[model samples]
Target: MISVAAIDARIWQAIVAGAFVAIGWIVNGWQNRRVAAALRAERTRDVHRALYAEIASCLANLDSPEALAAYRDAMAARMRDDPGFVPLIPRERNDTVFRALVAEIHILPRVTIDPVVSYYSQLFAIEAMIADMRGERFRALEPERRIAMYEDYIALKVQAFHDGHFALRMIDAYATDGRNGAMEEEARITREISAGFDTAGAAARAASRISSPGAVRSGRSPE
Candidate 1:
């Protein structure tokens, strides 16, 4: 039979061992969580960085009508290849948020005061019209009506492209006329708007909200 003292000592040893094991498990779990969170943040940051770069490239190419049209076509192709690129899906709240943000930024008079603003405004109007037509309520419309709406959308897109080209030509003319300061001002405003949209904190928050597990089920994410 074991002595009482020995029994008590063994029990204490067991308790201490268990406590250490528990602490180790907790520390391991915490470390794993930290690593996973960091990886997720890195991935999200990369995605948003790519998106901002694409937007900046598009804006820069607006100076060339051919490039603008090419960009638009590339965007349309991407939308076709990746349904996620289309903002029509209700579950894709980020898409809608991005579109709304772009529209709001475009409409701001600070940047829109330039002649190019008219062209962008028209482009945004077409985008809004397309969004409306894709809404759930519009699904019940007759086939013919849907066709007409689509035709109108195409027409608007083409007209906006032409207008954008014309605006680019005007910008070129201004450059030739030595109104370089005005062009510089426009470029500065564009950079400011891009910076505002691409701020790391804001993009991180937006990505976090969109990628949250709860957002997947809700079809919407918190602002």
Candidate 2:
């Protein structure tokens, strides 16, 4: 038979070994969670960079009075020929990646997120306006009135131009410098657009440039 003292010592040793195993398991779980979280964050950042770069490219493509001119020319010709034409708005952003990472967008820093979301939100509005213009009711309006309606869309184009510039700068900052730099760049771009840029005048110039042979399609970069 085993002595009681000897039996108690064996039991205590077993208990100590089991406690060590449990502790190790817990530590491993914690380490795995931390690493997973880090990986998710890195992936989110990468997605944001790709999306941002696309938006920056779109901004570069559309920020010119020439691009807006092309659209106006196309619309004027469409009004004359197609008669049921829906004027094209200049919003060439790619949102497929953005939709794919919807969950990660919520986790991103708000300073950067705000600009991106704002830019896309305006695009959504432009899309809605486009649909409305294409509807039967808008097309039924007199040709002169139709032209006037499309001219009123100058507001949307001008606002979008500024929004694109601001958002792209914010995205570039995050990709290049950092978030703090992104916020600063955003603020500066907003001020610059607000002060020196004549939104109405630019739209007017673009519209004026649209002349005879207004067959230029939207989406082509200006020369």
Candidate 3:
């Protein structure tokens, strides 16, 4: 027995309530999406920052001529002291970071991408050299053969490390801003990056000197 006017008023109230609820839901969802997008951006930045630093540090370690010489000498000593034992030099590469960046590469700057790609490509070449040197046949070959061929591998590693430093510098250049202390900090970092490249270059030059023709021939030597 409700009046027609009362029925219409109730219907209008229901409709108004539903409309408000819908609007509130949309607003909340939109805000959540914005927050999530921001968090993702921050995470991506963090990943890149960590990746650049790690690659630089790893290259520095690998391109250390003193460390390489020490490792070589240690290996020789171990062979003499324990003929049955073998030691492996630990290899470091930013593979995880690389994959992560590749997954989100669409968001990265094009200039940044090129240097990063070059750095990784160089690393890949160095890795391939290492893999070839560590193959079963390689170990079975004459020790002299190994020594002769290792020069080129060392050269590749050094050059790859040098490229990694270059890539880091490129990234630094792009990220720098003319803010308080930013220029000074960037200059300092650039100097450090340059020093890394110098170390790698020196290592490459030394290895190149030892990359005699005999080494090339040894690559095709019969077991």
Task: Return whichever of 2 and 3 wins on TM-score.
Answer: 2
Q: Indicate the TM-score of model 1.
A: 0.34
TM-score comparison, 1 vs 3, better candidate: 3
| Lowest lDDT 10-residue stretch of candidate 1 | 214-223
Tell how far residue 214 is off in model 1, in angstroms.
Answer: 30
Summarize candidate 3's per-residue lDDT along 108-215 as a digit string, tens digits.
455455667887887787777677766787677566556545656666665666666555554444444212233354466568777764434543333333222221
Model 3, residue 78: C-alpha shift (Å): 10
The residue-by-residue lDDT of candidate 2 on 1-223, one tens digit each, is: 9999999999999999999999999999999987777765566456555555555554544556556767766777778787666554433445666667777676556656787788777767767777777778786888767877776665566566666555555555554555566667667766866798643333233323322121111111111
Candidate 2 Cα errors over 4 Å, as ranges: 1-8, 65-94, 100-104, 142-144, 176-223
Q: In order, what lDDT does every prediction score?
A: 0.45, 0.60, 0.57
Ranking by lDDT: 2, 3, 1
Model 2 scores worst on lDDT over the 10 consecutive residues at: 214-223
Clashes of each: 0, 0, 0
